[model samples]
Target: MKGFKEFLLRGNVVELAVAVVIGAAFTNLVNTFVKGVINPIVGAFGTKDLASYTSCLKGPCETGPAGEVTSGVLILWGSVLSAALQFLITALVVYFVLIVPMNRMAARRKSLAEEAVEAEAKEVKLLTEIRDALVAPLR
Candidate 1:
Protein backbone atom coordinates (compact mmCIF):
# COMPACT_ATOMS: atom_id res chain seq x y z
CA MET A 1 0.00 0.00 0.00
CA LYS A 2 2.83 2.36 0.91
CA GLY A 3 4.68 1.48 -2.27
CA PHE A 4 1.53 1.95 -4.32
CA LYS A 5 1.02 5.37 -2.83
CA GLU A 6 4.61 6.30 -3.59
CA PHE A 7 4.27 5.04 -7.13
CA LEU A 8 1.19 7.14 -7.73
CA LEU A 9 2.96 10.20 -6.36
CA ARG A 10 6.02 9.66 -8.51
CA GLY A 11 6.68 12.43 -10.99
CA ASN A 12 6.69 10.22 -14.09
CA VAL A 13 3.44 8.50 -13.13
CA VAL A 14 1.67 11.76 -12.49
CA GLU A 15 3.04 13.29 -15.66
CA LEU A 16 1.97 10.26 -17.71
CA ALA A 17 -1.56 10.38 -16.31
CA VAL A 18 -1.84 14.07 -17.10
CA ALA A 19 -0.48 13.47 -20.58
CA VAL A 20 -3.06 10.74 -21.26
CA VAL A 21 -5.93 13.01 -20.22
CA ILE A 22 -4.60 15.95 -22.20
CA GLY A 23 -3.95 13.75 -25.24
CA ALA A 24 -7.54 12.51 -25.21
CA ALA A 25 -8.82 16.08 -25.04
CA PHE A 26 -6.46 17.19 -27.77
CA THR A 27 -7.61 14.33 -29.99
CA ASN A 28 -11.21 15.54 -29.69
CA LEU A 29 -10.20 19.08 -30.55
CA VAL A 30 -8.26 17.92 -33.61
CA ASN A 31 -11.14 15.67 -34.72
CA THR A 32 -13.55 18.59 -34.42
CA PHE A 33 -11.25 20.84 -36.39
CA VAL A 34 -10.87 18.27 -39.14
CA LYS A 35 -14.62 17.66 -39.30
CA GLY A 36 -15.73 21.27 -39.03
CA VAL A 37 -13.04 23.22 -40.87
CA ILE A 38 -11.01 20.87 -43.04
CA ASN A 39 -13.90 18.79 -44.28
CA PRO A 40 -15.85 21.87 -45.36
CA ILE A 41 -12.86 23.31 -47.17
CA VAL A 42 -12.35 20.04 -49.01
CA GLY A 43 -16.08 19.84 -49.51
CA ALA A 44 -15.84 22.75 -51.93
CA PHE A 45 -14.27 20.23 -54.29
CA GLY A 46 -16.76 17.39 -53.57
CA THR A 47 -18.63 15.99 -50.57
CA LYS A 48 -18.72 18.02 -47.33
CA ASP A 49 -17.89 15.01 -45.16
CA LEU A 50 -14.56 13.35 -45.83
CA ALA A 51 -15.81 10.08 -44.42
CA SER A 52 -18.40 9.91 -47.20
CA TYR A 53 -15.70 9.78 -49.85
CA THR A 54 -15.07 6.20 -50.84
CA SER A 55 -13.72 4.13 -53.69
CA CYS A 56 -15.56 1.04 -54.73
CA LEU A 57 -13.19 -1.91 -54.50
CA LYS A 58 -15.74 -4.32 -55.86
CA GLY A 59 -18.41 -3.91 -58.51
CA PRO A 60 -21.58 -2.05 -57.54
CA CYS A 61 -20.58 -1.03 -54.03
CA GLU A 62 -23.67 0.29 -52.29
CA THR A 63 -24.34 2.18 -49.09
CA GLY A 64 -27.43 2.26 -46.92
CA PRO A 65 -29.31 5.44 -45.99
CA ALA A 66 -27.01 5.97 -43.01
CA GLY A 67 -23.98 5.44 -45.28
CA GLU A 68 -23.23 1.95 -44.03
CA VAL A 69 -21.85 -0.39 -46.65
CA THR A 70 -24.76 -2.54 -47.74
CA SER A 71 -22.95 -4.62 -50.35
CA GLY A 72 -19.71 -4.95 -52.25
CA VAL A 73 -16.24 -3.99 -51.00
CA LEU A 74 -15.54 -0.31 -50.43
CA ILE A 75 -12.25 1.36 -49.79
CA LEU A 76 -13.03 4.22 -47.46
CA TRP A 77 -10.19 6.39 -48.65
CA GLY A 78 -11.79 9.56 -47.38
CA SER A 79 -11.91 8.34 -43.81
CA VAL A 80 -8.28 7.32 -44.07
CA LEU A 81 -7.42 10.72 -45.46
CA SER A 82 -9.24 12.44 -42.65
CA ALA A 83 -7.43 10.34 -40.02
CA ALA A 84 -4.09 11.05 -41.69
CA LEU A 85 -4.78 14.75 -41.66
CA GLN A 86 -5.68 14.66 -37.99
CA PHE A 87 -2.44 12.79 -37.20
CA LEU A 88 -0.36 15.29 -39.14
CA ILE A 89 -1.99 18.23 -37.46
CA THR A 90 -1.52 16.70 -34.03
CA ALA A 91 2.15 15.92 -34.71
CA LEU A 92 2.81 19.40 -36.08
CA VAL A 93 1.20 21.14 -33.14
CA VAL A 94 2.89 18.94 -30.54
CA TYR A 95 6.29 19.34 -32.16
CA PHE A 96 6.13 23.10 -32.44
CA VAL A 97 4.26 23.89 -29.23
CA LEU A 98 5.68 21.32 -26.81
CA ILE A 99 8.80 19.55 -28.08
CA VAL A 100 10.49 22.58 -29.59
CA PRO A 101 9.96 24.79 -26.55
CA MET A 102 11.04 22.10 -24.14
CA ASN A 103 14.18 21.46 -26.17
CA ARG A 104 15.00 25.19 -26.21
CA MET A 105 14.49 25.44 -22.44
CA ALA A 106 16.70 22.43 -21.82
CA ALA A 107 19.45 23.87 -23.98
CA ARG A 108 19.22 27.20 -22.18
CA ARG A 109 19.51 25.51 -18.78
CA LYS A 110 22.50 23.48 -19.94
CA SER A 111 24.29 26.59 -21.19
CA LEU A 112 23.61 28.42 -17.92
CA ALA A 113 24.92 25.49 -15.92
CA GLU A 114 28.07 25.35 -17.99
CA GLU A 115 28.60 29.09 -17.54
CA ALA A 116 28.22 28.78 -13.78
CA VAL A 117 30.77 25.97 -13.68
CA GLU A 118 33.22 28.01 -15.70
CA ALA A 119 32.77 31.03 -13.43
CA GLU A 120 33.30 28.94 -10.31
CA ALA A 121 36.47 27.41 -11.75
CA LYS A 122 37.83 30.88 -12.57
CA GLU A 123 37.04 32.14 -9.08
CA VAL A 124 38.77 29.16 -7.52
CA LYS A 125 41.87 29.66 -9.66
CA LEU A 126 42.04 33.34 -8.73
CA LEU A 127 41.75 32.56 -5.02
CA THR A 128 44.47 29.93 -5.30
CA GLU A 129 46.80 32.41 -6.98
CA ILE A 130 46.21 35.01 -4.29
CA ARG A 131 46.84 32.50 -1.47
CA ASP A 132 50.02 31.25 -3.14
CA ALA A 133 51.36 34.80 -3.56
CA LEU A 134 50.69 35.69 0.10
CA VAL A 135 52.21 32.47 1.44
CA ALA A 136 55.31 32.73 -0.79
CA PRO A 137 56.06 36.22 0.45
CA LEU A 138 55.69 35.09 4.11
CA ARG A 139 57.99 32.09 3.47
Candidate 2:
Protein backbone atom coordinates (compact mmCIF):
# COMPACT_ATOMS: atom_id res chain seq x y z
CA MET A 1 0.00 0.00 0.00
CA LYS A 2 2.77 2.41 0.93
CA GLY A 3 4.76 1.48 -2.19
CA PHE A 4 1.75 2.02 -4.41
CA LYS A 5 1.09 5.40 -2.81
CA GLU A 6 4.70 6.43 -3.32
CA PHE A 7 4.60 5.32 -6.92
CA LEU A 8 1.49 7.35 -7.57
CA LEU A 9 3.01 10.38 -5.87
CA ARG A 10 6.32 10.17 -7.70
CA GLY A 11 7.13 13.23 -9.83
CA ASN A 12 7.59 11.38 -13.11
CA VAL A 13 4.37 9.39 -12.64
CA VAL A 14 2.41 12.52 -11.77
CA GLU A 15 3.93 14.43 -14.67
CA LEU A 16 3.08 11.59 -17.06
CA ALA A 17 -0.52 11.47 -15.84
CA VAL A 18 -0.87 15.24 -16.31
CA ALA A 19 0.71 15.01 -19.74
CA VAL A 20 -1.72 12.31 -20.81
CA VAL A 21 -4.71 14.30 -19.64
CA ILE A 22 -3.47 17.45 -21.35
CA GLY A 23 -2.68 15.52 -24.53
CA ALA A 24 -6.20 14.12 -24.63
CA ALA A 25 -7.69 17.58 -24.20
CA PHE A 26 -5.34 19.05 -26.79
CA THR A 27 -6.41 16.32 -29.22
CA ASN A 28 -10.01 17.59 -29.06
CA LEU A 29 -8.86 21.10 -30.01
CA VAL A 30 -6.81 19.73 -32.88
CA ASN A 31 -9.72 17.60 -34.06
CA THR A 32 -12.06 20.61 -33.92
CA PHE A 33 -9.66 22.73 -35.99
CA VAL A 34 -9.16 20.05 -38.58
CA LYS A 35 -12.85 19.22 -38.86
CA GLY A 36 -14.18 22.77 -38.77
CA VAL A 37 -11.62 24.59 -40.88
CA ILE A 38 -9.33 22.28 -42.81
CA ASN A 39 -12.02 19.77 -43.66
CA PRO A 40 -14.15 22.44 -45.37
CA ILE A 41 -11.26 23.61 -47.50
CA VAL A 42 -10.43 20.02 -48.29
CA GLY A 43 -14.12 19.43 -49.00
CA ALA A 44 -14.12 22.21 -51.57
CA PHE A 45 -11.72 19.99 -53.47
CA GLY A 46 -13.91 16.91 -53.06
CA THR A 47 -16.22 15.58 -50.27
CA LYS A 48 -17.39 17.63 -47.30
CA ASP A 49 -15.79 15.28 -44.79
CA LEU A 50 -12.73 13.26 -45.57
CA ALA A 51 -14.08 10.42 -43.49
CA SER A 52 -17.00 10.22 -45.91
CA TYR A 53 -14.56 9.52 -48.75
CA THR A 54 -14.17 5.84 -49.41
CA SER A 55 -13.73 3.25 -52.15
CA CYS A 56 -15.46 -0.11 -52.24
CA LEU A 57 -13.37 -3.21 -52.45
CA LYS A 58 -15.51 -6.32 -52.40
CA GLY A 59 -19.07 -5.29 -53.24
CA PRO A 60 -21.32 -2.31 -53.61
CA CYS A 61 -21.10 -0.14 -50.51
CA GLU A 62 -24.36 0.52 -48.74
CA THR A 63 -25.34 3.58 -46.69
CA GLY A 64 -28.11 4.07 -44.18
CA PRO A 65 -30.64 6.93 -44.25
CA ALA A 66 -28.23 9.17 -42.35
CA GLY A 67 -25.46 8.30 -44.84
CA GLU A 68 -23.63 6.10 -42.37
CA VAL A 69 -22.03 3.02 -43.82
CA THR A 70 -24.27 0.02 -43.40
CA SER A 71 -22.35 -2.65 -45.24
CA GLY A 72 -19.22 -2.46 -47.27
CA VAL A 73 -15.61 -3.49 -47.70
CA LEU A 74 -14.11 -0.04 -48.00
CA ILE A 75 -10.55 1.07 -48.46
CA LEU A 76 -11.31 4.18 -46.36
CA TRP A 77 -8.01 5.80 -47.29
CA GLY A 78 -9.38 9.32 -46.83
CA SER A 79 -10.15 8.72 -43.17
CA VAL A 80 -6.61 7.47 -42.75
CA LEU A 81 -5.31 10.57 -44.46
CA SER A 82 -7.36 12.82 -42.20
CA ALA A 83 -6.14 11.03 -39.10
CA ALA A 84 -2.55 11.28 -40.31
CA LEU A 85 -2.97 15.02 -40.80
CA GLN A 86 -4.33 15.38 -37.27
CA PHE A 87 -1.31 13.52 -35.92
CA LEU A 88 1.06 15.70 -37.87
CA ILE A 89 -0.57 18.88 -36.63
CA THR A 90 -0.46 17.66 -33.04
CA ALA A 91 3.20 16.78 -33.37
CA LEU A 92 4.08 20.12 -34.87
CA VAL A 93 2.23 22.08 -32.19
CA VAL A 94 3.71 20.07 -29.35
CA TYR A 95 7.19 20.42 -30.80
CA PHE A 96 7.06 24.13 -31.48
CA VAL A 97 4.92 25.31 -28.58
CA LEU A 98 5.95 23.00 -25.73
CA ILE A 99 9.12 21.07 -26.45
CA VAL A 100 11.16 23.86 -28.00
CA PRO A 101 10.39 26.38 -25.28
CA MET A 102 10.89 23.88 -22.49
CA ASN A 103 14.26 22.92 -23.92
CA ARG A 104 15.37 26.54 -24.08
CA MET A 105 14.26 27.13 -20.51
CA ALA A 106 16.06 24.04 -19.28
CA ALA A 107 19.24 25.11 -21.01
CA ARG A 108 19.05 28.54 -19.41
CA ARG A 109 18.55 26.97 -15.97
CA LYS A 110 21.49 24.63 -16.46
CA SER A 111 23.76 27.48 -17.47
CA LEU A 112 22.77 29.55 -14.45
CA ALA A 113 23.37 26.62 -12.11
CA GLU A 114 26.81 26.07 -13.56
CA GLU A 115 27.66 29.75 -13.08
CA ALA A 116 26.48 29.65 -9.47
CA VAL A 117 28.62 26.61 -8.73
CA GLU A 118 31.65 28.26 -10.28
CA ALA A 119 31.10 31.46 -8.27
CA GLU A 120 30.82 29.45 -5.05
CA ALA A 121 34.04 27.60 -5.84
CA LYS A 122 35.87 30.83 -6.45
CA GLU A 123 34.62 32.30 -3.18
CA VAL A 124 35.68 29.22 -1.25
CA LYS A 125 39.15 29.35 -2.78
CA LEU A 126 39.51 33.02 -1.89
CA LEU A 127 38.41 32.38 1.72
CA THR A 128 40.90 29.53 2.04
CA GLU A 129 43.76 31.70 0.77
CA ILE A 130 42.87 34.46 3.22
CA ARG A 131 42.89 31.99 6.13
CA ASP A 132 46.34 30.68 4.99
CA ALA A 133 47.84 34.16 4.80
CA LEU A 134 46.53 35.12 8.23
CA VAL A 135 48.01 32.00 9.87
CA ALA A 136 51.33 32.00 7.97
CA PRO A 137 53.18 34.39 10.33
CA LEU A 138 52.03 32.47 13.39
CA ARG A 139 53.27 29.15 12.00
For residues 16-105, write the lDDT of model 1, one tens digit per residue.
999999999999999999989999999999999998888887689988999788999999899999999999999999999999999999
Model 2 lDDT on a 0 to 1 scale: 0.93
* Stretches of candidate 1 exceeding 4 Å from the true structure: 64-67
The true-versus-predicted C-alpha distance at residue 80 of model 1, in Å, is 0.4
Give one digit per residue, the lDDT tens place, for model 2 in 81-128: 999999999999999999999999999999999999999999999999
> Relative to the unseen true structure, what is the C-alpha lDDT of residue 14 in candidate 2, on a scale of 0 to 100?
91
**Looking at model 1, which ten-residue stretch has the lowest summed lDDT?**
50-59
Model 2 TM-score (2 dp): 0.74
For residue 21, give model 2's deviation from the true position in Å.
3.7
* Deviation in Å, model 2, residue 130 alpha carbon: 1.4
Per-model TM-score versus the true fold: 0.90, 0.74
